[model samples]
Structure formats: structure tokens, C-alpha cells
Target chain A: MARFGMVIDTKKCVGCQDCVIACKTENKVPEGHDRDWIVTESHGKFPDILMEIRTERCNHCSNTPCVSCCPTGASHIHDVGGVVLVNHDLCIGCKACVESCPYDARFIHPDGYADKCTFCIHRVEKGLKPACVEVCPTYCMHFGDLDDPNSEVSKLLQSRKYHVNLPEAGTQPNIFYLI
Target chain B: MHEIFTTRNNPYVDPIMAMWEWQIPVYLFLGGMVAGMMIIAGYFLFSGRHKESNCACFSIPFTSLILLSLGMFALFLDLAHKPYVWRLYTTFQLKSPMSWGAWILILVYPALIANILIRPSQWMINRVPKLSEIAGKIQQHHILIRNIGILNMLFGLMLGAYTGVLLSTLGSRPLWNTSLLWVLFLVSGLSAAAAYVHLVAKNKAESELLAKADNGFLVVELFVFVMMFLGLLSSAKPHIEAANLLLNGAYAPIFWVFVIGMGIVIPLIIQLLAVNHKVKHTPIAPIMVIVGGLILRFVIVSAGQYSHWFNAHFH
Candidate 1:
């Protein structure tokens, strides 16, 4: 029942990639594979340009196409927190979920199964935040149960104007970016 | 209030999914060809074209079993956890195309076996003496044979459509998101199967008929490809760019040269010529069709990976 989510404050982000590094280390995401990454876009003419930087990872949408396409139920929503997780043991490495992810979030781990940002469910279960959130130098990343009105992530959404990536995708992503 | 920037450019360039290699496409191509072959064999049985039916049936069961095994082997190679492959059959997920495909594939073998049982081959009889008695008993009941044929056709159609559906269901890849993909794949499979049958068929009339049928499938496949392109072109910006990847981007040469030219157009023209008696019916055209069909799977699978939602939004 707890819809866990993240609210990323792009305005406060410096794009230091601390979150990316933290995620990689915390998850032991294998060499050359990323659980999280930085995305930056430069806008306007060079003289008056503005650069927007944000970290990216799995959106963990409510309607996850990855789960729907996975043959063996390898990819499924965690019963407790609505978190999208992959059961590596059951994975056929078909890459169906990898391709179905609109965010380009999921990757085939070198060890050979579809993998992505787990929202650090292990840490969450232990009352700890995701590694990226905990490591954000700018405090731009917020994580908590969005369904809980008292949760920081919920409060952040209530106060800030935010957008989700690829709205046309219709995944209803849980990751919200506060502009 | 300031205007927020919305530009289609991501400064970072990361590789997308590369786990699916040549094995995946090879499996898809083989699975599709087998499905098409079964469908053709079933049709022959239903129409009481016993000679043609026997020709297709004699080969289909064994060919399907071998090819399906090879395809499954390719799939097994792609699996990260080979030991866990059996978990796929534990339960069926209605929403999952893969689950459907797995179950459908399981059903395919039974239908194919039934087709063979209805008309046991001399080789099969020699190998398994009991098969002769079973074939005799089954042959006495015409309705049972017709029912098996229908089952084969249904399973074949599902298998053929499942190949494209497997890719098309991936919402992230714009190139594979078209509704027309399944149709294109089905037609291409039929064309490939027909061509294969034409090559192996001993009867002159059956081979000629299959050649003609393949031409029709080719023409429909061409149309489906066009519709797929135009459908993507008319969609959102990302979809249009995805279409461009095949139309005029990095994949242009392969798409046009290999998939379109070698796969559809050339094969279509050669078949037309052969059917019209302008050229002798050599194995050249049929071989091209089969090659083209294989290449089609490669192009679609690889190119679909190349066409990404993220890439479309940025550069």
C-alpha cells in the first residue's frame, strides 16, 4: 500500500554525479553498468545559455511495461512498497524489460539479468534512504512513501511544481522532478 | 516566471540493451519459419491436398522439433540463469507476451506431433513400429485429422504473431512499437516457409503453388512495412525520429539494402519472374526469400535496440 517514490529538485542539483557514484557503490552494480546516471541539457544561445542538470534512474512506474513483458515473472512489483524489482534467479535474460523501459533505466547486468535502480529497497527496509538520496551533496534528492501525507517526498510534491519524464509514455512514473 | 527549457538533447550517451545478440534474432527467425510451415501444412491437410499435405507434414514435425530445439538453445544461451529456465513453465501470466509465447510454443509441439501422428512418415514408422498402428487408426478418422490440422493452424498463427508481438510490446523502442509489426512478421514467416517448402517439395504443382503463395505474402509484407513506417512517421516527434533511423539514419543502408532490397523487393521480383516462366524455378529465389527473412529478424531486433525513446528525445 505504500507507494514509495522520489522527488528530485533539479533547481538545487549541481550535477556532481555523487548520486550515480553512490548508487553504483551501494548496489555493487557490476563494472561498466550504472544503476543511476546524470542527465544535463543546455538551452538558449551560448551567450545566455542555461544548463539544466538532473540525475536519472528507473522511474518504477505504477504500470511497469517491464513486468508485463517479462515471461517468468522475473520482473515484478514488490508486494510491500510497490517497488519494481527483478528476481534474477527467474530471469531468462530475454531483455524484454530492458527494452520495455521507456526511461532506458533497465540494463542487462554483466552477470546476465535485467537490473536497474531498486530504489534501494534493502536500505529502505532497514529504515535507511537510497544511497543516491543519502549521498546527494546538494540535498536535491528526496525519498519516502508518497502515499503517506506526512512523508517528506509527499510534502515536497505538494509544495513544488514537478514533472515526470516521458509523460507520453503513460507509465505514470513515480519519480517526480521538482523544477 | 521564466520559460522552462525543453530541448531534445541528453548530454550523456550510454549504451542501451545489448544483451540480445545474434542468438535472439536467430531464434525469432527460426521460430517464425516453423510456425509458418505448420500453418501451411495444416492448410494442406484441411483442403484434402494429401500429396502436398504429406509433403509438408512429413517434414514439418521433425523440422519444427529440431528448429524449435535450436531456437530454445539460443534462448537458453541468452539466459543469465540457465538453471532457472524451468520457472517459465511454472505459471502463466496472461499479460506477459513471453509467458503466452512459452505456453504457445509448448502447445505447438503437441499440435505438430498430432499432425505427424495423423500422417506418419515411413521413416518415423521404421524408427517407431507402434507409430504405424497409431497412424492407421488415426487415418480411419478423417474428422480427427481435420481437427488436428485446425489446431496446428491456430497454434501456428499465434506463434507467428508472437514473434513480432514480442518486440512490439516493448513500449520503449519506438521502431518496434507499431501495430503492423505482427502482421509484417507473420507475412514474412509465411513467405519464408513457402519458399522453404517450394525448395524441398517433390511435386511440381505443389512447389509452383507455394511459389505463387509466397509472392502474395511478399507483397503484403511490403505493404505492412510501409504502413509501419508511415504510422511511426505520423506519430509524435520521437516516433518520427525512430522511423527516420530506418528511413535515412544510421540504419538506412541495412534497412533499405538488406531488409527491403534483399528481403522483400528482390525476392518478390524473382518469384514473379519464376512464376511467370520468364525465369526457371531454381532454388535461387527461394533461398533469397529465406535469407531475406532471417535478415529481416536481425534488422528488426538490432535496429529496434538502436531506436530508443531516450535517443529520440535527445539527439
Candidate 2:
């Protein structure tokens, strides 16, 4: 009954992209495809601009359009922690899930399966942090059960002023960013 | 100036989901065209035109079988996981338009085949001797023919609307978000079919009749186009950007010239002239309508893929 999510401190990210590399290497994502990426957003005038560094991936929303739009039920939520995962064997590679994702998270793998970051469930299940979470030089990313009040992700979200991306989308995304 | 830069670079989702290309559009056009054929044939059947010496419905059903199969082949080609195509039939996904389409597509086959057996051609029976027996058996049950006609029309409606709904259901693309696309594509399909029947039907009366229907459909399709454009332009920033892609972006020339000017407007004018007996009916007008229908699918599919969520900085 665990709900997994991420809480990242954009103030401390430093835009290093180590997490991006760690994800690619850990997942063995095919050439020319990255399951996750970094975004450097800046706002306000030059002298007073505030910049934020974000490492983004599949939000694993509570109501996922990708899963709903999948014709073959190839995309489903894992029972372990509500992680969205794709069953490559059943996938027809119609790319419907790819088009339905608002976060622009998924891509059709070269081998013809829709793919995205799995939240490193293999590591997460083994009581190890996701590769990206483990490799962040500044300890900016934290992964834990968002549903547990005692989980680090829940505590971080409770203690900080945070927001999820694309609130207007209403997907109720699990990932939270500390402003 | 507020600015945002992302290092996301997957080919399928760099700026948008560009994986759907010409193959998907071709399949949609053919599906729409087949939808048109089945509906027209069913209408003829319902009106007792099937009893006529040489009703266009007789020939249309036969051609629809081939055309629909060809369209399915195009869809098959677009499947990245070709080996697993049958997986579509394993489950009926209530939320997926494609699942609805897959089931509808299969149902269409039986409807079409039944229509063909309603009056199988002598030439076909000569080639396939067993067709005679099957045709005789089917013709025995008058009620079945009526049911087949209804099935054809029902499936045709779904097929035509499904093409647009297919694109519309994918909320990620701002360009395909509007429900008007369903009505737009259905009217376009009907117009395209009417034009095609006008050109190819053996009966001059039927041809003339379809010419008029095509004119009406063309008018509606034009209105739908305007509504779709206005709907997108009036929405959120991403939709406006998507509409601009057709209005004045790289796709503007093709969208304006080929889809609107040549496909809908010009053909409607010519058919209007021909219908008034002011000019002889030439193959040019109908051909333009058919080609226009195709080009519409292409423009929608390609432009839709290029449309993205608003840039974070701009937002």
C-alpha cells in the first residue's frame, strides 16, 4: 500500500546532470534515448532572476492517461509501490502511451516498446535508492513513500514550500519540488 | 526574459511525439474512405436500391472489402511491434479509442462480406465457385440483408468518427484535443465517398445524386474546418501555437493550398457548376475531393505531432 514519489531540492541541484547519466547507465537506455532529463528554468529580469534546476522523469500520476490510453493494457501500475511500468511483451508499440503522457516522459524504444523511467524499481525493491538519487552529488533528490507520514519524501514535502509540475494538468503527480 | 532549457532528447519525444508519420495518416485516410463507402452502400440498401438492375451498392460493397483490407495493411505497417499485432484483440480496453477501432474494424469485415453476398457478382462466382452457394444462402434470409445494412451503417459511423477520435483522445497533443475533429473527419469521409461514387458508379442517376450529396458534405466539412481552427485559436497558449502551425508555420502552404483551396473549396465550386448543368461533369472534381480528403489526414497527423505543450519560459 506504499505510494512512491520524489522530492528534489531545486535550490541545491547545481544542474550537474550526473543523475541523467546515472539513469542512462543504470537502465542501459538505448542510444539516443534518455528515460529522464534535466531542466534549467530561469525567471524574472537578469539582475533579479531566480533560476531553478530540475531533474525530471515520469511523474507516475494517480490518474495516468498513458495507462488509460494503452489499448493492450501494456502499461500498468506495479503493485509494489504504484510505479508505472510497461509490459514489453504485451506492448504493440502503438505509441499511444507515448502521445498521452503530459510530462513528455515516454518514448518508443528502438526495440519497439514504449519506455520511460521505472523509478529504478529493481533498486528500490532491494532497499537501495534509485540510481539518480544515489548519484546526486548535492543530495538534491530524495525517493520514498509519499503516502507514509514518516517517510523522508513526505516529511520533506511537509516541511518545505513545494510544488508539482503542471498543476493545471490535474494528474495529481507524485513528484514534488522544493522551491 | 524568463527562460527554460531542457536536456530531454529522446527522438520520439524531444519536442513532441513525432513517431506517427505518413503510415498512420495513410491508414486513417483509408479507414475514413472505407467508412464512407460502407455508409453509402448501407443507405442504398435501406432505400431498396439494391433491387435495382445495377445499384452502385452492389459494386461498392465489393470494393470496400478490398479497400478496408488495404487500409488495415497500412496500419499493420505502422506497428513497431509487428509480431505482436494480435495483442490488440486479446482485451477490450474501454478507454482506448484504438481498441474500439480494432473491434469496429473487425465487425466491418463481416458487415461488408455479408453485403457482398447479398448480391455476389457473376464474375466473382466464376472465379470462386463456392461464392454462388454462399450468395444463394444469404439471399434466402431477407431479414439478414436488412440487419447487414444496419451493421454497415453503424460500423461506418464509428469508423469515420474513430479516425478523428483516435487522434483526439491523445490529450498530449493540443492540436488533436478538440472533439470537432470527429465530426470533421466523418463529414470529410462522407464527402469523399460521395465524390468517389459520383465518379465511378455505372448509373448516371446515382452519380448525379451523389454529386449533390458531396456538395452538401463539402459545405459542412468546410464549416467544421473553420470551427476547428477557431476552437484551437481561442484556447490555451499551446493550442494557439498548434493552430499557428497550420495558419502560418512551415505546414501553412500545404494546409492552405492543398487541403483547403484545392481539396474542399475548388471541388465544391466545380461540382456546383456541374450540378447546375452549366458545365460537363469531368473526373477532375471528384479526383480533387478524394485527394483533398487524403491530404487533410496528412496535415492533421503531422501538424498534431509537432504541436507541443507551451514552452515553460513563454508560459
Candidate 3:
């Protein structure tokens, strides 16, 4: 099966939080609850310093701990595209999967359901990009199937040395960052 | 002291803000205990000689089921929206321990009810003269159900440990991430169950039963307590720092008074004195131990969450 992944070019990214607002509006995500955030890395001493910002969301791991630990089989990767999605109907809101997630990507919604980025599965079904991807002014986030050699994401991975978050976790996150 | 609580200047965050409160912890503690106790209760009901069986085997399941249901309700009440809470079951994720816990409860409830129903019926047949003959015959058919009780007990233990594992899985939460978390939880669960049993029976445990269950439970709890603290001491910087916040920070008083003094020291001393005096068993010792166990749960849940590591990025 083809695996969908994204390569985020942090060098080209501005950390404008457009992705955050765009995702919220598209998904109707609750206020005070964020599905994505910009992590600002600051360096240097005294007056001279530099700040680098990276936007983070679910990395859509291949070996997801959340799916492994879910007792009721509520957390699973979509067979068609390997997107992680929660089966709200089967979930008991025990928050085990939330606790197990390494990225802190998921949260308990006001309705007590676990919610996170689904890689915009609904939009993907319609052959459209995720809301964040559609809204990125810089076009820093690139999404495509990794299986096809000619795919954009596949091409980026072939050409650039990128970093994946928390590599030690061995989740094999599909999201690659062009650091 | 009041200034620390009122002002945002203190880097610490009250546990109430971070997650559940005293009531919820109490509820969790009770729910786990009931789960463990029911399993133990079910085990004894089937294996041991009927006449030799003590009140404990029967009472544990009966009381535990009642408390388990009650604790489940208390948890719901703690939530902001009790009515829509059913949505939680549907919003499942394997990565979320809360989701795992929800399913555990779902499985445990039916097992608990089955054990509760089976034991009494068996007891009635054994005790009531008129029904004794048919009851004995029917009891033979209950082998499958009895085996289910054994399975349930083992499942309950897993559920109980999952509670601690759930918290420990949060790598950023230093205090909870210790390897000792599972042991601490198991010991606490057993102790809490023993304590509830002690309290319910008015601490009137027979010497043999106390020797097997209560005395052993308290001693094991003490061992776990020592190991937990020692483990915290030996851990890396983040965990050690988190431990210090409990021993020396704003939560020290509660830790010392309720958790250590009342919960462990006093109860240990009483149990020791009883053992030394050759009393064989004493209600006072177990009663104190029970109270101590409950207080320990309250303190650990509260103290562990009393402070937060100030965000390094923010500072």
C-alpha cells in the first residue's frame, strides 16, 4: 500500500502559525486546544541570538505505540494511506493512547474524545491536500505518496538529508523535516 | 504559604489544575483495589474448602463490586459533563491509556458481577439445609464460571498496574516515569484492598487471615515504599528533582504528616508492636494500616502532581 508522508522544509518556513489557525478553522478544533504548534528553538548568548521555529503535529508513525496499546482497537492506521485515526465510537476515553503518544500530538476534546491530525483523510479522499498544506504561504510543507518513485515527497527524501522527531522512539514517523 | 498558592511567582502548579483531584485519585485507588480484591476473592471461593473458607473470600467480592460501581460513578461525577461521557468509549485510541482503562473497566464489570452472583448462590446451597442437596449438584456445573473468576482476577491485576503505567508513560512527567511505578501501584492496590477489607470487617481479622493477608500486605507495602523512595533517589536529574519537590518543596508538610507519619510510620509501629507482643492479631493494627493506606494514595496522587517543571523555553 502507498504511504502518504510530508516533508517540512524548516529552512523555508516562517513559523507564522498560519497552519495552526488554518487547521483549527478547517477541523472546527476547540479553542485553547491546538492540533498543531510552532516550537521555537533559540540559541546564542547575551544580545546576539537566533530563533528557529518548527511546526509540529502527528507524524503518522508506522509503528505507532498508540495503536499498539489501545485495548479496544480504537486507534489504528488507515489501510488505504497509513494515516492514524481514532475510532471515537470504540474509544472509552481512558486516555491511554494519549499517554502513549510520544509526540504529545493528541488531546482529549471537550466531548472527552481523543482528537489529532488525521493527515486530512477526508480531504485526501477528495484528492486534496490537508488544510495546513493548502494554507502554507511559503509552500514549505510537501505531501505525496512515498511509494511512487516520481512522487514529490519521495523526490525530497531522495535529495535532502532531513530529520525525524525523536528517532529513538522508533515510530518511523513519516513526517520528515528538511533541517 | 498562602502567598505561594495565590501568586503565579511560584513555579509550581497545584495538582487540581493539571488533572484530577483528591476525589478522583480516591476513586482510582478504590477502583483498582476492588478489582484486585475481587480477583483474590474469586480465587479463594473455588479452591478452598467450603467450611474452611473465611468471611474474607465472600465479603471481598461483595464489598468490592459495590465499591467498584460506586468508584466508577464518582469518576463520572468528577467530569464536567457526565451526560456526554459515553462519547469517551467511542473516541478510542490504542496509544491513550485512558482508552485502555475504559475498556478494562468494561471487561471487569461483567466479570465482577458474575463472580458476585456465583459465590452467593454457591454459599446459599452449602448453607441452607433444604437446598443443600440440589445446590451441591448445581455447584458442579459452575466449574466454567469459577474458572472465569480466576481469569478475571488475573485481568484485574493487569488493570490495576495499568493505572500506574498510564501515568509513568508520560516521559515528560518525571515523577511518574520511574520504573518503580508499576511496583508502587501493585503494592498500593493490594494494600488498599487489604485496608478496605480491614475497615469493613471492623479490623476483626482472625490471626490466621491477618498473618496471611493483612500483616503480609503491610510489610510488603513498607518494602515497596522504601524501594520507591530509593529508586527516586537513584534516578537521573529530572526524577531526582521531582522527588525533591515532594520532600523539600511546598508539599513536604502533607507528605510528612499524612503520607509518612499517619500513613506509614504510625501503622508500621502498631503492626510491629502487635507482632512483638505475640498478640497473634489485633484489630487496632489493621484498622490503622487501612487508614494509612488510603492516606498514602491521597498523598502520592496529590504530591506527585503538586509542581510542574517550569517550561525551559519560556524562562
Candidate 4:
């Protein structure tokens, strides 16, 4: 009955990539695969440069293209809390989901199935924050129930200036970046 | 030639959805071959020219098998996991064009092959009246094959159009979302199919039949091109931008040099000149027309994909 979400304050993010390392280690993710990571978008050259470092994950979209594209129903919204999860057993690894995804979030794993961040459902079920959220020394990452009015995530949603990546995609991402 | 494209940023990411590097060419080749064979088969069936029809009978089956088989294989290659691709057939959705295509290939391919083999078996059985039972069986097969041929033709029509429909279905991708997309695909498919059959006929034996096929194909191809160009012009902003890319942007050289210049204008001019002069020396024009048609498919498939992806990313 809960809708879990994350809020990362970009101003506080130092682009240290601690969240990326924590995710990789916790998930046992292979090298060259970052479940959630930062991209530094730099405008202007040399002395006049302005860099916007964006941290991103699967977005746990409300209407996911990846889910629509998965022919075998390997990828689905988890029943418990609506987290996007890929069942490796059911996956045919056709890569249709990969192609249809506009955000470039999902990837074909070394095991030949679509893989993305699961919002650390295993940890959340155990009543702990995701590894990425725990390791963020800047306290940039915040995770709580979006539906619960008194929850931190809900309070931030009510008060903060935030943005979601590729909102035009109409996925209504759960991850909100407070710029 | 290589220098021009070297410094060019690929812009294609790990999941190459739209750069359309090789998939477009493969699609063009397959669609052209299928359409070419279909047109030839239809012509032979309708013409009732039994004796000379042997050329078409042999070539149609052979070409159909090669094109469709190769096409399906190319499609598998396009997949990230080629091994489990059979699941596509088992787990199918009627609403999705891709699922429809998978079903189309599954039903039509074996049917086409069986039909092609029947002609030779019938010929063999006729030589020996002692094999009357065998001949009867062959006759039954011939009937079945004929029925299958009908199915293949229907599938070919869908196969021709599905390429466009598949791309157009992505409504978010503005460049490909057009009502005209399906029509363009069908037209291109038919044109390409005609050329392929004509070429095959020429290779088998130099005959007036080949010339006739060439002439019919040229006329149909020209008509389709006109419709496709008009559709391109009348489409929404995304398709219009896609058209502009073909006419003026990065793909302009390929479009102008290969598709428009060689594929359309040159072939049209050749066909016209040959017709006006009543010259038997103008067989080269028909061949050129076929080549042009193939090139046109290549250009459109490639350009349509590139523009569609480019627009999506930028948006």
C-alpha cells in the first residue's frame, strides 16, 4: 500500500560517486554497470563553465516503456510497493525493452536479461535504507513513503522545488532531484 | 570517403535503438526481395502463361525463402539475446505489430517453401503414369501449395507494410508517427520485389518474359514512389523533419546520390528513353530501375530510423 520514492538534492551532491559505489557493491553488480550514477552536463568551455551533475536510476516509472516492451513479462512492477523489478528467470533478453526505454536506464546484463535498479527491495523489505542512501555523506539522498502524508519524502514533495528526468516520457518517475 | 564520417560523433548509445546502422539495409533487402517475388508470383498466376511461367515458378519460391529466411535471421541478429528469441512466437501479442510480424513469418515461410517444391514434383510425376498414386499425391500437394501461395501473398502484403507500421506505432517518436508510413512501406516493398524477380529472371535465361516482368515492375515501382514522396510531404512535423533530413541534412548525400538520383530519376529517365525510342538495346534501363528501387528502400529505411531516434533524443 506504500509508494516509495527518493529525493536527491543536487546542490549538496559533490559528484563523489559514493552512491554509485555503494549500489554496485550492495547489488554485487559487475564492473562497468552503475545501477544509479551521476552525469556531469557541462555548458561553456574553460573559465566560463557551468556543470550540472545529475544522479539517476531506473526512476521506477508509473508507466514504464521497458515493461510494455518485455514480451515474456519478465519485467514487471513489484506487487508489494510498485517497484520495477526484472525477473531473470522469465526474461528472454530480447532487448526490446532496452530499445524502447527512452532514458537509457535499463541494460542487458552479462547474464542476458534486462537489468536495472530495483530500489533495493531486498533491503527495504528488511527495514533498512538502500545502500546508496546510507552511504551518501552529503545526505543528498532521501527515501521514504510518498503516500504517507507525514513521511519525509511526502513533506519534501509538498514543499521543495524538484524535477524528474525526461518528464516528457510520461513515466512519472519516483526519483525526484531537488535542483 | 571515410574521412568525412570519422570525426562524426556516433551519437548512438549502448542500446542502439535508432542509429539504424545495419538493420535498415537488412530490412530493405528483405522487404524488396519479398515484394519482388510476390509481384512475380501474382503476375504468373494471373497471366496463365503456363509454359513460360516455369521461370517465375522456380525463382519466386527460391527468392521468397532466401529473403524471408534471411530477414528472420537478420531480425534475430538484431536482438540482444538471439538464443531465446523463439519465445517471441509462444508469447505473442496481437496488438503489437512485432508480434504480428512474428506470426506472419511463422505461417507464411513454410507455406511458401512447400509451394515452390510442388511444381518440380508435379513435373516429375507427369513423366511417369506408372506413378499415378504418387502423381495424385503430388496433385493434392499442388492444390495445398496453391492455397499456401494465397496465404503467402497476404502475409507478404503485411510483411511489406509492417516495417512502416512498426516504426509508426511509436507515437512519442514524432518522425515515424504517420498514417502514410504503412503505405510507403508497402509501395517500397512491391517496387523492390519486382526488381529482384526481374533480375532473377534475367540470370536464369534472356527472354522476352524477363522484359515483360521488368516493364510491369517499373510501372508499379514508379507509381509507389510518387505516393511515397507525396506522403512524405504531407506528413506531420516529425515526418516532415525526417523528410528534410533526407532532402537536406546528414542523410542528404545518400538520398540524393543513391535513392533520388540513381534510384528514382535515373531509372525513370532510362525507362522513359527506352519506351520512347522503341529500342531493344534498352534492357539496361530496367535493370537500373530495379537497382534504383532497392537503393530507395535502403535510404528510406535508414533515414526514417535515424530521424525518428534523433528526434526522440533531442526532445
Candidates in order, TM-scores: namely: 0.93, 0.97, 0.75, 0.77
How large is the interface RMSD of each prediction? 6.3, 1.8, 8.9, 7.7
Best candidate, lDDT: 2
- The true-versus-predicted C-alpha distance at residue B229 of model 2, in Å, is 2.6
Off by over 4 Å in 4: A1-4, A42-51, A144-150, B1-24, B39-58, B121-149, B170-174, B177-179, B202-244, B275-315
Worst 10 residues of 2 chain B by lDDT: B306-315
- After superposing candidate 3, which stretches have Cα over 4 Å from the reference? A147-150, A158-161, B1-24, B39-54, B75-180, B200-208, B225-257, B278-288, B291-315
Per TM-score, the best of the predicted structures is 2
lDDT of 3 by residue, A1-179 (tens): 98999989988888888998888899998877777777666656657665556777888898887777665676788986899999776655555565456566777777766778988889988999999999999999998898889999999989998888766556788888886
Q: For each candidate, what's the DockQ?
A: 0.46, 0.71, 0.13, 0.25
Quickly count the clashes in candidate 3.
Answer: 26
| Rank ordering of all candidates by TM-score, starting from the highest | 2, 1, 4, 3
Cα deviation of B8, candidate 4, in Å:
19
| Top candidate when judged by DockQ against the true structure | 2
Clash pairs (backbone) in predicted model 4: B35-B193, B36-B193, B36-B194, B263-B292
Decide which is better by lDDT, 1 or 2: 2
Model 3 DockQ (Cα-based)? 0.13
Question: Candidate 4: lDDT of B75?
Answer: 66
